[model samples]
Target chain A: MDWIAVADVVAAVLMLCGAFLVLAAGVGVARFPDLLGRMHAATKPQVLGLVLLLTGVGLRVHAWDVAGMLFLVAVFQLLTAPVAAHMVGRAGYRTGKVDTSLLALDELTPDQEAAERAAQDEADGETEQADADPR
Target chain B: MSPATPQDAGWWARWRHRMRTQWHAALWLMVVWVLLWGGVSVANVLAGTLVGFLLISVMALPSIDYRGRVRPVAALRLLGFFVRDLLVASVQVSFQALRFGWTPHGAVVRVPMRDTGDLYLTVTSVLTSLVPGTVIVEAHRITGTLYVHVLDLESSGGADAVRHHIHELEERVLRALASDDELAHAGLGPQGTAVADARAVEAMAGDVDPGAPSVTPEEDRP
Candidate 1:
């Protein structure tokens, strides 16, 4: 086989694999129960898939000009993806989109539990005063 | 107002500080310019540098406070370990995804990061998130904790495993990038107890004996 033909065959396989990974990510998003879960689906495989697709493109192009640009794309994707995921995950957690029952451990629970206890005690005190005053 | 005037310090000192502040950003911008135009000839490099300086003039970024010296050997070790974890975790996540509609027991595990510098925390969190099965949901700067969402919790041993794995990653990052001062700040100075404990635990875990006890002293205490 010609050298170009070999490169084309490899690139085709990589592109297909990348497509499959992206499909998996889509399925993951649809199937996951919570926002955080979906964010994982949105990030992990998709980034890898993007890398693969870019690699495929670079392989086929085989030109330094385009290859250099492709390298930038890969670097930027890597730098941005995790930061974006971190932001979305933080928002989801703060918004109470995270289901506590499914979570193995939550450090925030301690602070939340303390707040609830304080509120409960105040409510109990108010009820006691109402009962005592016969209002 | 800027603290030091041109006469307040030596000319060389002022120039060096300015160079240090702009060099990284300028170099990165130059690289991007060259890539955008294509080719690595002398003309492209020179033009790219010119454009880079122009961009830097318009947008002055804060200089990075890099405290650590780069240890290439340690960095290579961390990279090797990270790549292995990435592949293994990716495969695991893909397998879990294959089971349609099956939601693995997911949880936000809080790992302590107290006393670690901001740089270490940022580096460790980013590294941890790149692996497929875990994502950092929240990082508490005050409390020094990272709440990581881990997939496929095995009810019995999963949380502990995740915690240990994350700590190991942090240890690796510390070894790879942390300077003496940063390590000391994190209580992992050249001969710190934390690093010692981690190594001891790692050594213990490497045992291949099936008859050996699964629980270590640390696990037993907790």
Candidate 2:
């Protein structure tokens, strides 16, 4: 009975901490200035928060099936959240939501510009070939 | 995953080759299957094996070969660091979120990864993004650069500090994953120090220069 009580106490503490982290994440998304900044707020904290909450559930429930499912959920969240964050971040960058003036330094713009120039050159070469071929 | 034998081989031979080469993936899928059902049973294992094999045959993705040996000690250390970083970043971001009237400034700094493998690049990028303040915005495959968006640019000790931090993480990753030859090729000793103290000093020096330019030296670019 004491063991159960201890587990319950631990679970309650974990759940409380997890709730606070998720609340921080929520506030971050609402308060952050840029699209990219908000993306950080949306994904990162929620990941740890979800893990904590799932762990609390695992301890509170104390069953193998629930534990297994919770483990899978945590692993999947770790794997997928970054990919989702990256997708949103890349898209936000390309769509000009990133707000460059607010940035301390920007290296992606130069790379993007360089890639565009290279693509332009390739297009020009193809155009010249078309002109020459009379196709 | 690479096929152990070419497709021109007979289907039976190919299947056998795949069975040998992709046992790990199958095992992982089996685990996933069992977990999804929230139980481990003989029937679940058999069915999961069948489904995993079937999926492998159906999926024709590009093959990625990892030529690194896993160092258990280094890998565990990396995991420890990752957990510590996760906690540190979580607290910092939470503080930033709760603080009033302070809009955080971020930077998109391209950090060159010394290791040349796609596996290393992908792993490092995923790990970097999983940490709270940093998100991988773009990756240039040819130059092996990751453009990371940092949540607190000044607090991150500026671009150079962030770059060094990622490079250090990448080194830990390579230490965990890369073979000796690969490590040497990346200018890291098996023990994770540089060929000389020069690189370490350079990293240390860069940490002091907050808001440094985003330019890599011409030699480092390629």
Candidate 3:
């Protein structure tokens, strides 16, 4: 095959892969059991798919600077997407929207746990004194 | 001479510190944006910078205390993992799509989260959403519950497996950002067990009934 033809084939393959990835993210959003899982599906593939598609476009355009810029876009996406997800997840947690049954340890707010422990200790002390005094 | 006055001053000081940090983040984002657009034109760069600054200023209210500076290497590692996972999931999902059509058992699951700060959670959510066949529907901020839609609940290797996968993803994020002590205080580490258990329960609830119709019949139809 001529070089141009070969380039076209490669670009086509990359584009296909990118499209498939985007589709996968859509499916993941539809199929994952929870928000977190779905978010995982959405961000990762979207970033990669965009990267792949951009790479294909870059190849077709044959512009080194544009391709390099596209690479930077991918990198910035890699950096920012997680930060956004983290903020959303934390907000969800603090608001008490999370189902506790999904957790094994239930770290319950630290201050609340500490207060409970202190109350229990005081109650125990009072009971011991009452028992000793036999009132 | 008043304690309240000092407290107010302290608060403002903290606020200013946060603002400064945000400004730095804004500057970085502007640079990245400019680079991404691949324009050396002064007008484009100035406009991009202004937009970035405005965004940061508007969203400058400090909520979570993320103490450390950004670590590029850690961020890179997370990106690497995301890329790897995406490729694998893409292949697997494509096969399923081709073979079984689009209708897969779908359910919304609530996943309790460990207290790993806002940043980590945001990253986790975005990463998870990027995976094929999943979507983040709603995140309950108070309860740390993540409501997600999933495909193929029956053949999706059970809820426990899914929970495990999610936990691993979160763990990676925590390791990337927070120190051990910070993680512990955030109710991460061993305390995260509770969150994991809760996820398992939710996953079980999400198990699709085989007899029930799949959600995406149109996509699945050959």
> Whose TM-score is greatest here?
2
Which ten-residue region of model 2 chain B has the weakest summed lDDT? B213-222
Give lDDT per model, in order: 0.72, 0.82, 0.60
List, residue by residue over A47-131, the lDDT tens digit for candidate 3. Answer: 7688789878877877766876877877777667655655554455456654544432232333334545765676877643222
In model 2, the Cα lDDT at residue B104 comes to: 92
Clashes within 3 Å, all models in order: 0, 0, 73
Off by over 4 Å in 2: A127-135, B1-4, B192-222
Better candidate by lDDT, 1 or 2:
2
Which lDDT value does model 1 have at B44? 89
Angstrom error at residue B58, model 3: 6.6
Off by over 4 Å in 1: A1-6, A112-135, B1-16, B155-157, B184-222
List CA RMSD, all candidates: 7.9, 4.7, 13.2
Model 2 chain A poorest ten-residue lDDT run: A126-135
Please report, as a residue range, the 10-residue window in candidate 1 chain B with the lowest summed lDDT.
Answer: B213-222
TM-score of each: 0.79, 0.89, 0.57
Of 1 and 2, which scores higher on DockQ? 2
- B95-178 per-residue lDDT for model 3 (tens digits): 554443344454444455665566776667777876655555555444444554454445555544444466657766775777
Interface RMSD of 3: 10.7
Q: Could you give candidate 2's per-residue lDDT for residues B1-222 as a string of tens digits?
A: 354567678978876776766777777888899988888899998999988878777763344577889999989978988998999898899889999899898889878777468899899999999999999998776667788999988889877778878887887798899998898888677573444355556654645554444333422442
